[model samples]
Target: MREAQFYNKIEDLIFCNLCPHGCKLSEGQNGTCRVRKVIDGKLYSLNYGKISAINLDPIEKKPLYHYKPGSLILSVGSVGCNFSCGFCQNFTISQTGETFFTTFISPEELISIALKYKEKGNIGIAFTYNEPSIFYEYIYDTITLLKDELDIILVSNGYVNQSPLKDIIKHVKAINFDLKAYNEDFYEKICHGSLEPVLKSIEIAYNYTHVEITTLIIPGLNDSEEEIDKLSLWISKLSPNIPLHLTRYFPNYKFQIEATPIETLVKLQRIAKKHLNFVYLGNVLLPSNTVCPNCNKTLIKRNGFEVQSFMTSNQCPFCSFEIEYIKI
Candidate 1:
């Protein structure tokens, strides 16, 4: 295990300041993440260099509609997470302390793999599948080495502390923050984390890198119209151009409920669209192409991961309005 970063020691107790949990450990105790453990009087990362999942996936799968639509990216993930969301989609990796399924890969080796995929329209690497922040050392090392050569993206729970987030977001090209809910009660009860830290993290990332948000609309949990209105309005305060994905959540992991109704998703989408210029639905068959906010013209078309860009340049083809993103 590699020595972890962003930690403090107080009277022989190791304090993990990686996230908001601030888990103070004593003699072989693990942090809330379960990946960082106190061993031999120091904090060490158990998930460091242990990659549980890796794949060359489409950028759209990251649900990043505005960034680079059709391009592919090399996505990798490690086990362990700070949050304990009951409806975690990738619970097999995210909620586990087990590294039995993980393959050890060095930072240099990951860079090599990303470079090999460049010719096949691969943009860069995405630290995804599981919570990437728990293994802070590995991500920092890899992104530091793989700078500028390829775009770095993260699909995160947004529970990370600001200092470490700022350290990494400056190097990151894009990120999809999972804003699970707008209520504090939901976060504390269902996710085992706080909402304020995630909000702060999102605010920080917005200034440093391209930011997008994904909210898995769980039935009767976070799908309320009032909450979505507040959520979208909050995002609009940041920037209306920031794409917000309202994903349809099905029962998974500990939350065994029915799938989200299509009608419910549509209603919330309408509510969110009032505050945000770009709001799209996911996890169901829906028309989610990017349209010009000014002219209402379809700029990018997507059918299940197959994307075709109609925008020849950065501006809209029909309206010539300046777009914040590049042609995909």
Candidate 2:
């Protein structure tokens, strides 16, 4: 158990300012995240160093198409999440605590493991699977230790507070933020969170490092054309080059809503492409290729997670159009 970073004491309760939740807990009480707790009138992170899952996955599996396209990354996830989404796919780990089976991997040991896979095209570490913002201290320590030796990526819900987000973004190279939905009601009722903080986080993150956004299109909830247009336009205002992923949603956890229609994903992708330069469909396989937004020339050909062919440089070989990609 490690002392948490973003919290302070009130009269008798400790207030956790990690995310927008601002959970106030008395002694021996856990926050809504199920990880952060109040012990002796101070906040503690119960999930620190307790890894629920780890794997070496293709960076594309993170759905990060624009950043480090073909490289593999050591993905690590800890328990607990700030949002209580009903359709959470990783709820087994994200909603559990230390009582659940987990391995204790120190920062030094994790770094050694990453270095061991350097020859296997492992670019660096990705704090993913669960909401990484809840495990801020562990991530901060590990990234500080690794520094520039390995690139750091975050797969997060992006519901973090400004101060902590700013502090951690410096060490991160790229991030895949789950935008979830554009409507405030959807955020409040479906995810038990708000939309404003997530939008704010995206705006703040892109300034420091590469940013990609993902929105899972659930059938009845956030799959409307208007919402997709608003979300795409908002992202375009930041930068049209930002890659947007429209993923299919399946029944999971508490939500038993039928899987999202492929037709909805295709329609939303077309609508998104109107404002965004790079748009891709996920989950159900369509064409997962990157094309030059200007000339509509296939720039990167991908077969599943494998990169079949791509331009040697950042510019399109045929049209010389600048491709928005981080060089691997």
In order, the Cα lDDT scores of the candidates are 0.91, 0.91
Report the error of model 2 at residue 296, Å: 1.5
* Clashes per candidate (backbone, < 3 Å): 0, 0
* lDDT for 15 (candidate 2): 89
lDDT of candidate model 2 versus the reference: 0.91
What tens-digit string does per-residue lDDT give for candidate 2 at 1-328? 8999989897997988889999878999999899988887788899999998999999999979888778899999989899889899999988776635989899989999999999999999999999999989999999889978999999999999999999999889999999999999999998999999999999999999999999999998999999999999999999999999999999999999999989989999999999999899999878889888778888778889988556877888889887665464
Give candidate 1 misplaced runs (Cα > 4 Å).
325-328
Segments of candidate 2 deviating more than 4 angstroms: none
Clashes of 2: 0
What is the clash count of model 1? Answer: 0
lDDT of 2 at 13: 79
lDDT of 1 by residue, 1-328 (tens): 7999999999989988899999989998988888999999999999999998899999999978888788899999999899988888899988888898889999999999999999998999999998989878998998889768999899999999889998889999999999999999999999988999999999999998888999999988899999999999999999988899999988889888899999999999999999988899999999998889899999889899999899767889898899874435
